[model samples]
Target: MKKFNITVNGNQYEVEVEEIKDSSTSAPRIQHQAPVAAPQPSAPTAPKVEAKKPVVTNGAGSVKAPMPGTINDIKVTEGQAVKAGEVLVILEAMKMENEIMSPADGIVKQIAVAKGASVSSGDVLVVVQ
Candidate 1:
Protein backbone atom coordinates (compact mmCIF):
# COMPACT_ATOMS: atom_id res chain seq x y z
CA MET A 1 0.00 0.00 0.00
CA LYS A 2 1.14 3.52 -0.75
CA LYS A 3 -0.05 6.86 0.60
CA PHE A 4 0.34 10.30 -0.85
CA ASN A 5 -0.67 13.87 -0.04
CA ILE A 6 -1.91 16.26 -2.70
CA THR A 7 -2.74 19.92 -2.78
CA VAL A 8 -4.93 21.44 -5.48
CA ASN A 9 -6.37 24.90 -5.64
CA GLY A 10 -5.22 25.57 -2.06
CA ASN A 11 -7.09 22.49 -0.80
CA GLN A 12 -5.25 19.57 0.78
CA TYR A 13 -6.18 15.91 0.25
CA GLU A 14 -4.69 12.54 1.18
CA VAL A 15 -4.92 9.49 -1.05
CA GLU A 16 -4.05 5.79 -0.54
CA VAL A 17 -3.56 3.06 -3.12
CA GLU A 18 -2.96 -0.71 -3.07
CA GLU A 19 -0.77 -2.31 -5.66
CA ILE A 20 -2.03 -5.03 -8.00
CA LYS A 21 0.39 -7.34 -9.77
CA ASP A 22 -1.80 -8.41 -12.72
CA SER A 23 -4.84 -7.16 -14.63
CA SER A 24 -6.59 -10.50 -13.92
CA THR A 25 -6.13 -9.93 -10.17
CA SER A 26 -8.52 -8.11 -7.91
CA ALA A 27 -8.80 -4.36 -8.22
CA PRO A 28 -6.67 -2.15 -5.97
CA ARG A 29 -8.15 -0.70 -2.81
CA ILE A 30 -8.46 3.06 -2.58
CA GLN A 31 -9.04 5.27 0.42
CA HIS A 32 -9.22 8.98 1.07
CA GLN A 33 -8.29 10.88 4.23
CA ALA A 34 -10.41 13.52 5.89
CA PRO A 35 -11.14 16.53 3.68
CA VAL A 36 -9.24 19.74 4.33
CA ALA A 37 -10.55 23.27 4.50
CA ALA A 38 -12.27 24.78 1.48
CA PRO A 39 -10.09 26.42 -1.12
CA GLN A 40 -9.60 30.20 -0.94
CA PRO A 41 -9.66 31.92 -4.29
CA SER A 42 -8.45 35.43 -4.91
CA ALA A 43 -10.77 37.99 -6.40
CA PRO A 44 -10.71 38.13 -10.17
CA THR A 45 -9.65 41.30 -11.93
CA ALA A 46 -10.75 42.80 -15.24
CA PRO A 47 -8.19 42.94 -17.99
CA LYS A 48 -6.89 46.31 -19.13
CA VAL A 49 -7.91 46.97 -22.70
CA GLU A 50 -7.24 50.06 -24.81
CA ALA A 51 -10.17 51.71 -26.55
CA LYS A 52 -9.98 51.87 -30.36
CA LYS A 53 -10.80 55.05 -32.22
CA PRO A 54 -12.65 55.10 -35.51
CA VAL A 55 -10.66 55.57 -38.70
CA VAL A 56 -11.81 58.07 -41.31
CA THR A 57 -11.45 56.79 -44.84
CA ASN A 58 -11.74 58.59 -48.18
CA GLY A 59 -15.52 58.30 -48.07
CA ALA A 60 -16.88 61.80 -47.73
CA GLY A 61 -19.26 62.61 -44.88
CA SER A 62 -18.91 59.15 -43.34
CA VAL A 63 -19.62 58.67 -39.64
CA LYS A 64 -17.79 55.77 -38.08
CA ALA A 65 -17.87 53.89 -34.82
CA PRO A 66 -15.24 55.08 -32.35
CA MET A 67 -15.11 51.64 -30.73
CA PRO A 68 -16.39 48.12 -31.19
CA GLY A 69 -19.90 47.72 -29.89
CA THR A 70 -23.54 47.15 -30.69
CA ILE A 71 -25.74 49.79 -32.23
CA ASN A 72 -28.18 50.71 -29.52
CA ASP A 73 -30.29 53.31 -31.33
CA ILE A 74 -30.36 55.32 -34.53
CA LYS A 75 -31.60 58.87 -34.03
CA VAL A 76 -31.55 59.83 -37.69
CA THR A 77 -32.74 58.34 -40.94
CA GLU A 78 -31.64 58.35 -44.56
CA GLY A 79 -32.01 61.68 -46.35
CA GLN A 80 -32.48 63.46 -43.01
CA ALA A 81 -30.77 66.83 -42.82
CA VAL A 82 -28.40 67.04 -39.88
CA LYS A 83 -26.03 69.59 -38.45
CA ALA A 84 -22.52 69.07 -37.23
CA GLY A 85 -22.37 67.59 -33.72
CA GLU A 86 -25.97 66.37 -33.84
CA VAL A 87 -26.44 62.90 -32.43
CA LEU A 88 -27.02 60.50 -35.30
CA VAL A 89 -26.59 57.17 -33.59
CA ILE A 90 -26.22 55.69 -30.13
CA LEU A 91 -23.53 53.04 -29.64
CA GLU A 92 -23.22 50.81 -26.64
CA ALA A 93 -19.72 49.73 -25.73
CA MET A 94 -18.26 48.33 -22.52
CA LYS A 95 -21.56 48.78 -20.77
CA MET A 96 -21.62 52.49 -21.60
CA GLU A 97 -23.76 54.41 -24.03
CA ASN A 98 -22.03 56.68 -26.54
CA GLU A 99 -23.56 59.12 -28.98
CA ILE A 100 -22.22 59.13 -32.54
CA MET A 101 -22.60 62.61 -33.92
CA SER A 102 -22.52 64.06 -37.42
CA PRO A 103 -19.19 65.43 -38.55
CA ALA A 104 -20.67 68.01 -40.92
CA ASP A 105 -23.98 69.56 -41.88
CA GLY A 106 -25.51 67.47 -44.67
CA ILE A 107 -28.27 65.06 -45.55
CA VAL A 108 -27.83 61.47 -44.47
CA LYS A 109 -26.73 59.60 -47.53
CA GLN A 110 -26.57 56.17 -45.98
CA ILE A 111 -26.85 54.26 -42.72
CA ALA A 112 -24.36 51.43 -42.70
CA VAL A 113 -25.35 50.08 -39.30
CA ALA A 114 -28.75 49.30 -37.83
CA LYS A 115 -30.03 48.87 -34.32
CA GLY A 116 -28.62 45.72 -32.62
CA ALA A 117 -25.94 45.44 -35.29
CA SER A 118 -22.42 44.76 -34.07
CA VAL A 119 -19.80 47.08 -35.45
CA SER A 120 -16.06 47.28 -35.02
CA SER A 121 -13.90 50.33 -34.72
CA GLY A 122 -13.82 52.35 -37.96
CA ASP A 123 -16.97 50.68 -39.31
CA VAL A 124 -19.20 53.19 -41.02
CA LEU A 125 -22.40 53.91 -39.09
CA VAL A 126 -23.83 56.62 -41.30
CA VAL A 127 -22.90 58.76 -44.28
CA VAL A 128 -23.95 62.35 -44.74
CA GLN A 129 -23.64 64.40 -47.91
Candidate 2:
Protein backbone atom coordinates (compact mmCIF):
# COMPACT_ATOMS: atom_id res chain seq x y z
CA MET A 1 0.00 0.00 0.00
CA LYS A 2 1.10 3.56 -0.74
CA LYS A 3 -0.12 6.84 0.75
CA PHE A 4 0.28 10.32 -0.71
CA ASN A 5 -0.87 13.88 -0.03
CA ILE A 6 -1.82 16.26 -2.89
CA THR A 7 -2.60 19.97 -3.01
CA VAL A 8 -5.16 21.34 -5.50
CA ASN A 9 -7.12 24.61 -5.58
CA GLY A 10 -5.58 25.61 -2.23
CA ASN A 11 -6.85 22.37 -0.68
CA GLN A 12 -4.90 19.36 0.62
CA TYR A 13 -6.11 15.78 0.04
CA GLU A 14 -4.83 12.47 1.38
CA VAL A 15 -5.12 9.26 -0.73
CA GLU A 16 -4.07 5.62 -0.49
CA VAL A 17 -3.48 2.96 -3.12
CA GLU A 18 -2.63 -0.75 -3.16
CA GLU A 19 -0.10 -2.37 -5.50
CA ILE A 20 -0.62 -5.87 -7.10
CA LYS A 21 1.92 -7.97 -8.96
CA ASP A 22 1.84 -11.47 -10.58
CA SER A 23 4.64 -14.01 -10.20
CA SER A 24 4.93 -14.31 -14.02
CA THR A 25 5.12 -10.57 -14.58
CA SER A 26 8.38 -8.65 -15.10
CA ALA A 27 9.52 -5.72 -12.89
CA PRO A 28 7.29 -2.64 -12.94
CA ARG A 29 8.36 0.39 -14.94
CA ILE A 30 8.66 3.83 -13.25
CA GLN A 31 7.68 7.10 -15.00
CA HIS A 32 8.34 10.74 -13.97
CA GLN A 33 6.07 13.72 -14.69
CA ALA A 34 6.41 17.46 -14.07
CA PRO A 35 3.57 19.59 -12.81
CA VAL A 36 2.39 22.33 -15.17
CA ALA A 37 1.01 25.77 -14.28
CA ALA A 38 -1.25 27.83 -16.51
CA PRO A 39 -0.10 31.27 -17.59
CA GLN A 40 -1.93 34.23 -16.00
CA PRO A 41 -2.81 37.32 -18.01
CA SER A 42 -1.91 40.71 -16.60
CA ALA A 43 -4.61 43.07 -15.37
CA PRO A 44 -5.65 46.04 -17.52
CA THR A 45 -4.42 49.49 -16.55
CA ALA A 46 -6.91 52.29 -15.77
CA PRO A 47 -7.00 55.55 -17.69
CA LYS A 48 -5.53 58.71 -16.20
CA VAL A 49 -8.00 61.15 -14.66
CA GLU A 50 -7.70 64.91 -14.15
CA ALA A 51 -9.58 67.23 -11.83
CA LYS A 52 -11.99 69.92 -13.20
CA LYS A 53 -12.68 73.36 -11.80
CA PRO A 54 -16.20 74.62 -11.12
CA VAL A 55 -17.74 77.21 -13.48
CA VAL A 56 -18.69 80.49 -11.91
CA THR A 57 -20.92 83.19 -13.36
CA ASN A 58 -20.98 86.68 -11.88
CA GLY A 59 -23.04 88.51 -14.50
CA ALA A 60 -26.15 90.48 -13.49
CA GLY A 61 -28.21 89.07 -16.39
CA SER A 62 -27.04 85.45 -16.10
CA VAL A 63 -29.57 82.75 -16.93
CA LYS A 64 -29.48 79.83 -14.46
CA ALA A 65 -30.77 76.28 -14.42
CA PRO A 66 -34.08 75.54 -12.69
CA MET A 67 -33.25 71.87 -12.06
CA PRO A 68 -30.45 69.39 -12.42
CA GLY A 69 -30.14 68.11 -15.97
CA THR A 70 -27.97 67.71 -19.07
CA ILE A 71 -27.70 70.45 -21.65
CA ASN A 72 -29.11 69.10 -24.93
CA ASP A 73 -28.63 72.17 -27.08
CA ILE A 74 -28.01 75.91 -27.05
CA LYS A 75 -30.64 77.68 -29.08
CA VAL A 76 -29.04 81.11 -28.93
CA THR A 77 -25.42 82.13 -29.54
CA GLU A 78 -23.31 84.89 -28.16
CA GLY A 79 -24.47 88.38 -29.27
CA GLN A 80 -27.74 86.85 -30.55
CA ALA A 81 -30.85 88.89 -29.78
CA VAL A 82 -33.58 87.11 -27.87
CA LYS A 83 -37.08 87.98 -26.70
CA ALA A 84 -38.71 87.25 -23.39
CA GLY A 85 -40.15 83.68 -23.23
CA GLU A 86 -38.05 82.62 -26.22
CA VAL A 87 -36.34 79.23 -25.87
CA LEU A 88 -32.64 79.88 -25.47
CA VAL A 89 -31.37 76.50 -24.31
CA ILE A 90 -32.73 72.98 -24.39
CA LEU A 91 -32.19 71.03 -21.15
CA GLU A 92 -33.02 67.38 -20.70
CA ALA A 93 -34.30 66.53 -17.22
CA MET A 94 -36.35 63.56 -16.04
CA LYS A 95 -36.28 62.29 -19.66
CA MET A 96 -38.11 65.45 -20.75
CA GLU A 97 -36.87 68.23 -22.96
CA ASN A 98 -37.02 71.45 -20.94
CA GLU A 99 -36.93 74.71 -22.87
CA ILE A 100 -34.93 77.35 -21.05
CA MET A 101 -36.47 80.60 -22.12
CA SER A 102 -35.10 84.13 -21.90
CA PRO A 103 -36.37 86.07 -18.91
CA ALA A 104 -36.57 89.40 -20.82
CA ASP A 105 -35.61 90.89 -24.18
CA GLY A 106 -31.82 90.81 -24.27
CA ILE A 107 -28.73 89.75 -26.16
CA VAL A 108 -26.82 86.57 -25.25
CA LYS A 109 -23.51 87.64 -23.79
CA GLN A 110 -21.93 84.31 -22.78
CA ILE A 111 -22.76 80.62 -22.58
CA ALA A 112 -21.66 78.57 -19.58
CA VAL A 113 -22.81 75.01 -20.18
CA ALA A 114 -21.88 72.95 -23.25
CA LYS A 115 -24.04 70.38 -24.99
CA GLY A 116 -24.26 67.05 -23.14
CA ALA A 117 -22.87 68.62 -19.99
CA SER A 118 -24.45 67.80 -16.66
CA VAL A 119 -25.62 70.81 -14.64
CA SER A 120 -26.79 71.42 -11.13
CA SER A 121 -29.79 73.48 -10.11
CA GLY A 122 -29.02 77.20 -10.32
CA ASP A 123 -25.95 76.58 -12.47
CA VAL A 124 -25.44 79.34 -14.96
CA LEU A 125 -26.56 78.51 -18.51
CA VAL A 126 -26.11 81.80 -20.29
CA VAL A 127 -25.44 85.47 -19.70
CA VAL A 128 -27.83 88.04 -21.16
CA GLN A 129 -27.32 91.78 -21.48
Candidate 3:
Protein backbone atom coordinates (compact mmCIF):
# COMPACT_ATOMS: atom_id res chain seq x y z
CA MET A 1 0.00 0.00 0.00
CA LYS A 2 1.09 3.52 -0.81
CA LYS A 3 -0.17 6.81 0.55
CA PHE A 4 -0.29 10.07 -1.40
CA ASN A 5 -1.43 13.66 -1.11
CA ILE A 6 -3.31 15.07 -4.08
CA THR A 7 -4.77 18.42 -5.06
CA VAL A 8 -7.64 18.84 -7.49
CA ASN A 9 -9.17 22.15 -8.43
CA GLY A 10 -7.38 23.68 -5.41
CA ASN A 11 -8.90 21.13 -3.01
CA GLN A 12 -6.53 18.91 -1.05
CA TYR A 13 -7.09 15.17 -0.60
CA GLU A 14 -5.35 12.22 1.02
CA VAL A 15 -5.34 8.93 -0.92
CA GLU A 16 -4.19 5.35 -0.36
CA VAL A 17 -3.48 2.88 -3.19
CA GLU A 18 -2.91 -0.87 -2.91
CA GLU A 19 -1.36 -3.06 -5.57
CA ILE A 20 -2.95 -6.40 -6.47
CA LYS A 21 -0.69 -9.13 -7.84
CA ASP A 22 -3.00 -12.14 -7.55
CA SER A 23 -4.20 -13.59 -10.87
CA SER A 24 -7.53 -14.70 -9.43
CA THR A 25 -10.59 -12.71 -10.54
CA SER A 26 -11.03 -9.83 -8.08
CA ALA A 27 -11.83 -6.14 -7.92
CA PRO A 28 -9.62 -3.56 -6.19
CA ARG A 29 -11.05 -1.90 -3.10
CA ILE A 30 -11.44 1.87 -2.67
CA GLN A 31 -11.74 3.83 0.56
CA HIS A 32 -12.78 7.46 1.04
CA GLN A 33 -10.32 9.59 3.01
CA ALA A 34 -10.81 12.84 4.86
CA PRO A 35 -9.82 16.06 3.09
CA VAL A 36 -6.63 17.75 4.18
CA ALA A 37 -6.49 21.38 5.32
CA ALA A 38 -6.87 23.92 2.54
CA PRO A 39 -3.64 25.45 1.32
CA GLN A 40 -2.90 29.11 2.16
CA PRO A 41 -3.72 31.64 -0.55
CA SER A 42 -0.71 33.23 -2.19
CA ALA A 43 -0.40 36.81 -3.37
CA PRO A 44 -1.03 37.19 -7.07
CA THR A 45 1.92 38.35 -9.15
CA ALA A 46 1.96 40.68 -12.15
CA PRO A 47 2.72 39.15 -15.54
CA LYS A 48 6.30 39.63 -16.70
CA VAL A 49 6.68 41.69 -19.86
CA GLU A 50 9.95 41.34 -21.75
CA ALA A 51 11.26 44.17 -23.91
CA LYS A 52 12.43 43.13 -27.36
CA LYS A 53 15.87 44.37 -28.36
CA PRO A 54 16.25 45.95 -31.77
CA VAL A 55 18.28 44.06 -34.34
CA VAL A 56 21.95 45.06 -34.23
CA THR A 57 23.75 45.48 -37.54
CA ASN A 58 27.35 45.88 -38.62
CA GLY A 59 26.70 49.24 -40.31
CA ALA A 60 23.97 51.62 -41.32
CA GLY A 61 21.57 50.11 -43.91
CA SER A 62 23.01 46.65 -43.31
CA VAL A 63 20.60 43.75 -43.99
CA LYS A 64 21.11 40.40 -42.24
CA ALA A 65 19.64 36.93 -42.29
CA PRO A 66 16.99 36.31 -39.60
CA MET A 67 17.86 32.58 -39.41
CA PRO A 68 20.43 30.08 -40.62
CA GLY A 69 19.82 29.37 -44.28
CA THR A 70 21.26 29.11 -47.75
CA ILE A 71 21.24 32.13 -50.01
CA ASN A 72 18.91 30.80 -52.68
CA ASP A 73 18.90 33.94 -54.81
CA ILE A 74 20.19 37.50 -54.87
CA LYS A 75 17.57 39.89 -56.09
CA VAL A 76 19.53 43.15 -55.94
CA THR A 77 23.05 43.87 -57.12
CA GLU A 78 25.53 46.26 -55.68
CA GLY A 79 24.87 49.88 -56.83
CA GLN A 80 21.19 49.07 -57.43
CA ALA A 81 18.64 51.51 -56.04
CA VAL A 82 16.12 49.85 -53.75
CA LYS A 83 13.10 50.91 -51.75
CA ALA A 84 12.11 50.00 -48.25
CA GLY A 85 10.67 46.46 -48.09
CA GLU A 86 12.32 45.48 -51.38
CA VAL A 87 13.26 41.78 -51.45
CA LEU A 88 17.04 41.68 -51.68
CA VAL A 89 17.72 38.01 -51.13
CA ILE A 90 15.82 34.71 -51.06
CA LEU A 91 16.99 32.60 -48.10
CA GLU A 92 16.19 28.89 -47.90
CA ALA A 93 15.82 27.74 -44.28
CA MET A 94 13.92 24.69 -43.01
CA LYS A 95 12.82 24.03 -46.59
CA MET A 96 11.10 27.43 -46.79
CA GLU A 97 12.18 30.37 -48.92
CA ASN A 98 12.34 33.56 -46.85
CA GLU A 99 12.72 36.93 -48.55
CA ILE A 100 15.32 39.21 -47.03
CA MET A 101 13.92 42.70 -47.43
CA SER A 102 15.58 46.07 -47.34
CA PRO A 103 14.92 47.92 -44.11
CA ALA A 104 14.95 51.38 -45.72
CA ASP A 105 15.03 53.03 -49.14
CA GLY A 106 18.65 53.11 -50.22
CA ILE A 107 21.23 52.20 -52.86
CA VAL A 108 22.80 48.73 -52.59
CA LYS A 109 26.34 49.52 -51.51
CA GLN A 110 27.67 45.98 -51.07
CA ILE A 111 26.74 42.34 -51.38
CA ALA A 112 28.03 40.52 -48.31
CA VAL A 113 26.73 37.07 -49.22
CA ALA A 114 26.69 35.25 -52.55
CA LYS A 115 24.01 33.09 -54.08
CA GLY A 116 24.04 29.43 -52.76
CA ALA A 117 26.11 30.49 -49.75
CA SER A 118 25.15 29.21 -46.29
CA VAL A 119 24.59 31.92 -43.69
CA SER A 120 23.74 32.01 -40.02
CA SER A 121 21.36 34.23 -38.15
CA GLY A 122 22.58 37.84 -38.11
CA ASP A 123 25.04 37.28 -40.95
CA VAL A 124 25.19 40.37 -43.12
CA LEU A 125 23.59 39.82 -46.50
CA VAL A 126 23.85 43.28 -48.02
CA VAL A 127 24.65 46.87 -47.15
CA VAL A 128 22.68 49.76 -48.60
CA GLN A 129 23.18 53.48 -48.18
Candidate 4:
Protein backbone atom coordinates (compact mmCIF):
# COMPACT_ATOMS: atom_id res chain seq x y z
CA MET A 1 0.00 0.00 0.00
CA LYS A 2 1.06 3.58 -0.73
CA LYS A 3 -0.18 7.06 0.28
CA PHE A 4 -0.33 10.06 -1.99
CA ASN A 5 -1.18 13.75 -1.70
CA ILE A 6 -3.44 15.36 -4.28
CA THR A 7 -5.11 18.66 -4.98
CA VAL A 8 -8.38 19.32 -6.78
CA ASN A 9 -9.50 22.89 -7.37
CA GLY A 10 -8.33 24.65 -4.23
CA ASN A 11 -8.74 21.78 -1.82
CA GLN A 12 -6.05 19.28 -0.80
CA TYR A 13 -6.35 15.56 -0.14
CA GLU A 14 -4.37 12.57 1.12
CA VAL A 15 -5.35 9.10 -0.14
CA GLU A 16 -4.11 5.56 0.31
CA VAL A 17 -4.27 2.74 -2.27
CA GLU A 18 -3.44 -0.97 -2.32
CA GLU A 19 -1.01 -2.52 -4.82
CA ILE A 20 -2.16 -5.57 -6.74
CA LYS A 21 0.01 -8.44 -8.01
CA ASP A 22 -0.22 -9.77 -11.60
CA SER A 23 -1.03 -13.42 -10.82
CA SER A 24 -4.81 -13.75 -10.33
CA THR A 25 -4.80 -10.43 -8.39
CA SER A 26 -7.82 -8.43 -7.33
CA ALA A 27 -8.69 -5.01 -8.96
CA PRO A 28 -6.68 -1.93 -7.87
CA ARG A 29 -8.36 0.56 -5.55
CA ILE A 30 -9.22 3.95 -7.07
CA GLN A 31 -10.20 7.36 -5.72
CA HIS A 32 -12.25 10.22 -7.18
CA GLN A 33 -12.54 13.92 -6.26
CA ALA A 34 -14.66 16.91 -7.25
CA PRO A 35 -12.97 20.27 -7.76
CA VAL A 36 -14.11 23.35 -5.86
CA ALA A 37 -13.97 26.84 -7.31
CA ALA A 38 -10.83 28.82 -6.48
CA PRO A 39 -10.85 32.28 -5.06
CA GLN A 40 -10.72 35.00 -7.74
CA PRO A 41 -8.79 38.24 -7.45
CA SER A 42 -10.79 41.36 -6.93
CA ALA A 43 -10.84 43.99 -9.65
CA PRO A 44 -9.60 47.52 -9.11
CA THR A 45 -12.18 49.84 -7.65
CA ALA A 46 -10.83 53.05 -9.23
CA PRO A 47 -9.52 53.76 -12.72
CA LYS A 48 -6.42 55.79 -13.49
CA VAL A 49 -7.12 59.47 -14.05
CA GLU A 50 -4.03 61.09 -15.53
CA ALA A 51 -0.90 60.32 -17.50
CA LYS A 52 2.36 62.13 -16.99
CA LYS A 53 3.28 64.60 -19.70
CA PRO A 54 6.74 64.47 -21.24
CA VAL A 55 9.41 66.80 -19.94
CA VAL A 56 10.22 69.82 -22.12
CA THR A 57 13.94 70.53 -22.11
CA ASN A 58 14.18 73.68 -24.21
CA GLY A 59 16.29 75.75 -21.86
CA ALA A 60 19.93 76.53 -21.02
CA GLY A 61 20.83 76.26 -24.71
CA SER A 62 20.39 72.49 -24.63
CA VAL A 63 17.55 70.39 -26.02
CA LYS A 64 16.91 66.89 -24.69
CA ALA A 65 14.75 64.01 -25.79
CA PRO A 66 11.40 64.04 -24.00
CA MET A 67 10.78 60.31 -24.48
CA PRO A 68 12.50 57.24 -25.80
CA GLY A 69 11.98 57.14 -29.55
CA THR A 70 13.57 57.27 -32.95
CA ILE A 71 14.61 60.50 -34.59
CA ASN A 72 12.39 60.71 -37.62
CA ASP A 73 13.47 64.11 -38.87
CA ILE A 74 16.04 66.76 -38.11
CA LYS A 75 14.83 70.17 -39.26
CA VAL A 76 17.82 72.20 -38.14
CA THR A 77 21.52 71.79 -38.79
CA GLU A 78 24.66 72.90 -36.99
CA GLY A 79 25.26 76.66 -37.11
CA GLN A 80 21.67 77.23 -38.20
CA ALA A 81 19.81 80.09 -36.58
CA VAL A 82 16.46 79.19 -35.01
CA LYS A 83 13.63 81.23 -33.52
CA ALA A 84 11.79 80.42 -30.33
CA GLY A 85 9.16 77.74 -30.86
CA GLU A 86 10.75 76.72 -34.13
CA VAL A 87 10.44 73.03 -34.82
CA LEU A 88 13.91 71.56 -34.81
CA VAL A 89 13.30 67.86 -34.87
CA ILE A 90 10.56 65.29 -35.25
CA LEU A 91 10.48 62.21 -32.98
CA GLU A 92 8.38 59.10 -33.42
CA ALA A 93 7.24 57.41 -30.22
CA MET A 94 4.29 55.16 -29.53
CA LYS A 95 3.27 55.56 -33.14
CA MET A 96 2.91 59.32 -32.70
CA GLU A 97 5.01 62.06 -34.21
CA ASN A 98 6.25 64.71 -31.77
CA GLU A 99 8.02 67.91 -32.68
CA ILE A 100 10.93 69.13 -30.59
CA MET A 101 10.92 72.92 -30.60
CA SER A 102 13.46 75.55 -29.77
CA PRO A 103 12.89 77.48 -26.58
CA ALA A 104 14.81 80.65 -27.47
CA ASP A 105 16.19 82.34 -30.50
CA GLY A 106 19.75 81.12 -30.95
CA ILE A 107 22.22 79.51 -33.32
CA VAL A 108 22.24 75.72 -33.42
CA LYS A 109 25.71 74.75 -32.31
CA GLN A 110 25.42 70.96 -32.50
CA ILE A 111 23.00 68.23 -33.39
CA ALA A 112 23.63 65.11 -31.33
CA VAL A 113 21.25 62.76 -33.08
CA ALA A 114 21.07 61.68 -36.69
CA LYS A 115 17.96 60.92 -38.63
CA GLY A 116 16.69 57.41 -37.80
CA ALA A 117 18.80 57.30 -34.63
CA SER A 118 17.23 55.97 -31.46
CA VAL A 119 17.32 58.11 -28.33
CA SER A 120 16.18 57.63 -24.77
CA SER A 121 14.36 60.03 -22.51
CA GLY A 122 16.57 62.95 -21.40
CA ASP A 123 19.21 62.24 -24.06
CA VAL A 124 20.73 65.44 -25.43
CA LEU A 125 19.60 66.03 -28.99
CA VAL A 126 20.83 69.50 -29.71
CA VAL A 127 22.93 72.36 -28.38
CA VAL A 128 22.28 76.05 -28.97
CA GLN A 129 24.37 79.07 -28.18
Off by over 4 Å in 3: 1-58
lDDT per residue for candidate 2 within 8-99, as digits (tens), equals 78455565554776567666655433443434449866879764222333558788888899999999889999887778889999999988
Off by over 4 Å in 1: 1-58
Per residue, candidate 4 scores C-alpha lDDT tens digits across 1-129 of: 787767666576667777666678565667754444455659745767764333357567889998999999999989999987788899999999998888778899999999999999999999877
Q: Per-residue lDDT of 1-129 in model 1, one digit per residue for the tens?
A: 777778887678877777767779665565658966665669866889875333343468888888899999999989899987788999999999998877778899899887999999988899989
* Per-prediction TM-score to the true structure, in the order listed: 0.55, 0.54, 0.55, 0.56
Best by lDDT: 3
lDDT of the structure predicted as candidate 3: 0.86
Please provide, for model 3 over 48-113, each residue's C-alpha lDDT reduced to its tens digit, 9 standing for 90 to 100.
Answer: 986433334566788888899999999998999998777888999999998778877889999999
CA error at residue 126 for candidate 1, angstroms = 0.2
The per-residue C-alpha lDDT of model 2 at residue 120 equals 97
| Candidate 3 local Cα displacement, residue 58, angstroms | 6.9
RMSD of 2: 19.4
Worst lDDT window (10 residues) for model 4? 50-59
Q: Model 1 Cα RMSD, Å? A: 9.9
Pairs with steric clashes in candidate 2: none
